[model samples]
Target: MGTKPKTRFGVIFEGAKRELFSVRELDNGDLSIFFKAPPFYDFLDGRSEKTLEHRYSFHRSLNSTPPAITLMRTVALEGGQIIRTSQLRWRAGESFSTMVFARACPTLRPEHYIMKERPKDTVILLYPIDIGRTTLFYHVVVTDTSLDPVIFRRSGLWVTSETFGHFKLVVLSGFFLILPFHRGFVSHAMTSKMRVDGQEIGADLPPIDLGNVSPERLLIDIGRMTTLLAEGLAERHISYIREQRYAERFVTETRQLLSLRPVPTPPDLPRR
Candidate 1:
């Protein structure tokens, strides 16, 4: 029997105005693109300093915010064919200036077809749209699943702030996980005795807590870690807090600590 053949696809991008733009694929199968539009500072009509400060703080707190762009778009290709549903869109308002944002080529693994032994010819064209219109252009080529060549292309003008706040959360969570682990070498080992239908099937192994810690302390630490993890997951629409067993334990422990009652100290008694 013969093996099935792979498909191919094509794509193209055209900017309404000449601007900076780039595209990259994330680890989680999401495609991301970043671009900048003309500076819109002049359009800040009667904008208060407080409002500006708030905007700046929000952007700063979330390091994943991309620079302002007049317009941005991303398209995904599988086996050389563009997947329409995977298209992403963004656009900024008309107030920003025309300085093009810096273009970036973050590390991305192009789909396997792009790296095939006999890769198909692909072209990406980018240029200015017009003098008054600050637009960028893109052209991509791909091969379809039926081994037919097809083109996927689109163009648009820049729009307002397009922030990747959710991506930032993922990065923050990763940083948190690494920080404590880097501070000291801590190891957690778990042993579970298996039983069939409630019958004892094995002897209990000795408990070994690699880190010098008590149950209360361990639970507290775990709770804090889970809190951060939960925050990150929630930002990414991952309901691990409710679905994962460990995450549930962390939530329970954290709530317990927050609601803990005061413990009374025993009175000293004189001995005869």
Candidate 2:
């Protein structure tokens, strides 16, 4: 008897099941998230590009009104033997819960995947992937028994949290949020008591009063707030050396595997 050969799907699933990101905390109370480019999904966007490195920052939202973190994605690309960088901003909504928000893996429980009547197609798995010591996250995966890879017809809701708990800030919803006042937040909502999942992480922020607003003197107040943003966090400069090394090693190995696969080029487009 001989062992079965590993398929491309098996290799992908193995790598996908592992922890995919590294994390650390910055001196300025910001969280840093580091991840590698997808091994299987090489063409993240439409181009002959592959990712080299990624530097993500979960910092204070400059907008302030949303009570979300500034999710900045900085990726280094290698295309045509030329290295370039790209950047973008996203928001990780504040939700401070460690329950089903993360860590819902079948390996931990085993009983969850043993349901008799539950449809396999409907089974969605969310596992807690420890990127670093600072925070935890849910890695979404779908149940698949076949060797063929299939796309899961679902989108993810990115609910993130800080070490202590959720932010006690109110995010104004709907069209009213488009208004310029209160940094796009409703003034009354900012001072209102809003709790997330009944967990109060921090003290409520007082109403931000811009006393007798004048356009000329606004720069003074903005300067003070900018200085305040740089204050140190309780856990300053936490490192994720081990996780970082793991992701880097995975990336190197994936690149090796990718080199073995031939990339298709169109006749109209010249190869780089």
Candidate 3:
């Protein structure tokens, strides 16, 4: 709330990091944050795994001529999963249950209700982030007209403690349904602890040190964004509720009219 948070932007291409970026190396054979390629990987591991430590190998290749460091948040689960504000079905509006659901689904669903299947270039309107000095493309081309939703595992957000972001305009190419992507953060101190307990091999810079995460300064910004989104969702829910109530009221108001207007009789049919 007081001062601005520091941030920088970079794209992470999971697993394909070495295949995409030209990792930087120091004279002593250590990797620097800068790279000539995109990065892929999550930041906060689901169970605190070494998803980030292994990224050091991206620089070890020395020959990896395509990418940059990976900073992933929530990893994808088995099948298609997403964090979405849209409820697939009617909600009971139970308070406790809503909070529980929100806790599990922190991010919005990447399932975009976009175009009818076609080869087109779509843009990810990056909010709270600016891709400066990087060659990453904001436009994602959907080349396949008849294919499943393409998960761009090769590109991920360079999340930082000082930044918070959301893609206002989004698409996963072919299919709107995409795999689950959890978004969360890991404490720097906890990450250090992971290294000593026979884990976190090939130590290197923390994500903050790497300068990959891009976010707006001030934690308050994130809170504000969350509040705005919640309020918008609440308004929509209320509107739906009103629609349902209106229908119920209309039925009640017309019931007496229907009852008084009549019981039709089948007169004159006896002539037949």
Candidate 4:
């Protein structure tokens, strides 16, 4: 009888030359490395299939030990999908997920969570704060409370990567749950403004090139801001539905929206 191959760990990434590479452990504990040229698809133009070629092989070895790879599942927006794979779940720890719903009041179920499929052009990243709560960062605002009845505004994080080309990596930054009406002697409001060291930023400013900034320094800034935001939310004592409900609803909706779409691809290099 033939014996099954032992499992091992490895890493995978998309190369600059439009190739997919993998470094995985062999049955005898040795490592194997190789690359594959993905079928041509105009990902930027969205004319072809969006299927990703490379994926984490963890799902294939369900009976393995120590889990060949650890992964986190995220919603489809912000470059996440309901599909299971390593690359999609690669940054699971760093990634957060949430849903925005129109809340009629603090003690009532949200009418329904808001949904947006094409958030790449404006949304940067999404940060999970808590169950049913998230933070979203925006470069542009196509739909706001003024035009539509969006009670909560989820914050998303934005980052740059070589594989994605001009397309920014969007992640969960935080969540903003809006109450339909003032609930008590206190209230809060959302703004399209930001400040660095007390210097206010204009809403019409262009997106910053992340390449020129130190990731550590930027993270420090984001952390401080996120802390402040959380503290402020706590102070407000805004009561709303918590996680279990939100999570269940989120998962169900995400699955329903899953479809074979073009795998998000990198855009042309940023102009020098």
Candidate 5:
């Protein structure tokens, strides 16, 4: 009998190299196109109420331009065969529109959560690219409300050994979430650093400099009771042991201090 190979999540970035060139070309083209248009004006004829809104429509257009890269998903089998499975495309010039939608209103549903959809948004265009034997596609999806939760909580932490630039962490807090994004580059090595409540702690590091003392020292300074509270939230067995040890040490020290009484000189036995 053969054993099944383990599968893991991975991200493959497309057209990353050509990103700068594509953006520059798109910006120049948009600028030239808008420069030919005349300025807007308002009229007070009373027949119609039209006002001039000269608000850099061209700049918005340029900012909304999509990247030339394409994104896709792949699956690999145990025997070392790679299979291209899913096609994930990027939407062009939909950034601003989506931002507007999210700012306006937001909603959450189980089914629509995974797939990106915008209720009050429109699509601009779809661009296709050829990656060797694979054909990739990019579509612009826009919305007036936030599309979806950036982080997948069930998956926990997503780590990669590639480059630090490609790493991303999406933290969800309350009704809003934050997505911290970075780009991958071949010239630099990937580094991972972690800090708990502004204090740096954890193994596997290029040693994140949190500008504060080490986590152990911080906990010690805060006292044993507070340290235990933090350890409870961490929910890690190792952390519990660490807290216990710290408490034990603290108790021992306190007892030692209490036991030490001022040594009596015995008054030199009344000068003997």
Candidate 6:
């Protein structure tokens, strides 16, 4: 065993665990990852004819929601350290407008929130979570896990799970987590309180008033809250192990599996 050859591994989500993609480690030590969209996946609707790059554009043209999902996945893959994400709107005649939210963080920082607003287009929120921050989220109902595998589960009050680095989250039943609300944008929810787990982490936390805030601002605040928690969890464990590399050998080894894998071809989406 010369040098014990460094091996590449990836963590698969429960849904994508099936062979919907291929992973190749390149000779230059980067991975070439190819992902095929499965049938009935929302991203495939109406945009099947588009290439990967154009598909992003096509999806952005119709709805801003799908691309945000993509960005969130990308952020998670990058260990949840997201500085900014862009939202683009397609205007008539193929014209596009873009909004950029940016932030610069200093090293060894404490938890804080910063807001920058551009009345017409952009709104920037920067909230950085310190290391070892843990938040315990409360949910009112204890339903089955069918809602979303990435977030909720059916287990009778499971303790907590790790996502990225130091973002450790625990969900409790009969308790609802109250998220911030931006005025005139976000629909109201039966409000509840969310607390941090340890005294050293989330002591004397302020309450979130969902009554009168802008939608963009609320989004930034919630996003920052989530980012900080996920960062804390990422610090706790090594979750994202796969990096992009082109591996000729991996392609050869998994060729049969790739060949037999059924790529999803969803029916044409309904005309908008």
**Highest-scoring model, lDDT:** 2
Q: CA lDDT of 163 in candidate 3?
A: 9
lDDT of 5 by residue, 112-228 (tens): 112222343221111122111111111111221222322222222111111111111111111111111111111101123223223434456353221222323422322333233
Q: Where does the lowest 10-residue lDDT sum fall in candidate 5?
A: 98-107
Report lDDT (CA) for all predictions. 0.23, 0.27, 0.23, 0.26, 0.22, 0.23
* lDDT (10s digit) by residue, model 1, range 1-272: 53322221111212121222233333332323332211211112563221110000111111223322211221222223221111111121111111111111111122311222223322222211111111111111111122111111001112112123221100000111111110111112223343223343456755522222232343344344445443443343233345588466656655654464422222331111
Model 4 weakest lDDT span, ten residues long: 10-19
TM-score of 5: 0.15
| Best-matching candidate per TM-score | 2
Q: What's the number of clashes in each of the models?
A: 46, 0, 26, 32, 10, 27
Candidate 4 ranges beyond 4 A from true positions: 1-109, 116-163, 172-211, 238-272
RMSD of each: 29.1, 22.6, 23.6, 22.2, 28.6, 24.9
Q: How would you encode candidate 2's per-residue C-alpha lDDT over 1-272 as one tens digit per residue?
A: 53222111000122233322344444465644444234211333654456565544445655665444433445455542322221212233422211100121112112211222212212111222211111111221111122111111111122221231212211000110010111100000122233323333346656543222221232243233223322211112122224787457545654554455332333432222
Instruction: Decide which is better by lDDT, 2 or 5.
Output: 2
Cα RMSD of predicted structure 5: 28.6
Q: How well does candidate 3 score on lDDT at residue 158?
A: 19
lDDT of 1: 0.23
What 10-residue stretch in candidate 6 is worst by lDDT?
179-188
How far is 11's C-alpha from truth in model 5 (Å)?
20
User: Which is superior by TM-score, 3 or 6?
Assistant: 3
TM-scores of the candidates are 0.17, 0.26, 0.19, 0.23, 0.15, 0.17
Candidate order, TM-score descending: 2, 4, 3, 6, 1, 5
Alpha carbon deviation, residue 160, candidate 4 (Å):
12
The better-scoring model by lDDT among 3 and 5 is 3
Residue 139 lDDT (model 5): 13
